[model samples]
Target: MPFASRRPRSYASPRALPSARARARHGRNGRSPVTGPDLPLAHTRLDAFEATVQATADYLQDLWPDELAALRIEVLPMPDQPPGVSGVARWRVIPQHRLVVLYRIPIERMSRLHREDDWHRRLMVESCVFRAVGELIGKDPWDLAPDRFRHW
Candidate 1:
């Protein structure tokens, strides 16, 4: 008969299949299928360096509000031109502009850390920030945060 066939037709239709865009969009759920909330987001070296610099700057600012009130902190991949006289400058301070620019590449890569670890790397970044701020304000790096290292 005309209705009879070798194989039976499937109930599901082609339209039911998810589109490529829908699949890419995670099928209405915003989160990626591969990454869940339990898994933390990737943190790159640059991100860690910037975070350390910012935290150090904030601490220094709290200690010397009046001095750093008008100052601006910035992070750049590298210096635009070679420093006038230096063995790979880690940072530059411009008192006229009240700006401190930290060179991420030189500061992170050039330093010789006796023990290479996350803590040491963070300490290195903090050192650069403190030195840069000290240079801007005509003060020694150690003097910037005196009580911090003092033990009672």
Candidate 2:
């Protein structure tokens, strides 16, 4: 009679999921016992993009200490481009200020080449920023950035 009415309970939110320490103590599987995979909700891609730009900026500042004041960093939604050709800007460099204009959408699109990997997406953003700076200064981006800066 006691066992007749008994039923298993369930957890609604992932927050109720067991912690690593708890799991280890109980000696359960690494993943959630009920759920197949332990995958949780993902964070925003905007935060990731911001972190990439900040990292790239820090690297550039380290590379060129004195010249940092002269160059400007601009983040725009998308680069001004012709319908088919995106090589929109005709002017070689800004007459007064050297600028690196990073178009978020275009770079994010390029980052889709390796959808799952974060390093690839970040590298794309960094490389795009480097390329923009190179265009402003009229130097090859490879020459400006370390060989390790290559993106997938």
Which number leads on TM-score? 1
- What TM-score would every model get versus the actual structure? 0.75, 0.55
lDDT of each: 0.80, 0.61
Model 1, stretches more than 4 Å misplaced?
1-33, 82-86
lDDT of 1 by residue, 37-95 (tens): 67976787877886787788889888999988887887878878755855777888899
Task: Report the lDDT tens digits of candidate 2 across residue range 1-152.
Answer: 01111133456635765677866766755644453466664556765775677677667667766655466665556656658874543222463656555666667864546455787777777877676666766667787656564676
State the number of backbone clashes in model 1. Answer: 0
Listing every candidate in turn, what is its Cα RMSD in Å to the true structure after a full C-alpha superposition?
Answer: 17.6, 15.4
Question: Candidate 1 has what TM-score?
Answer: 0.75
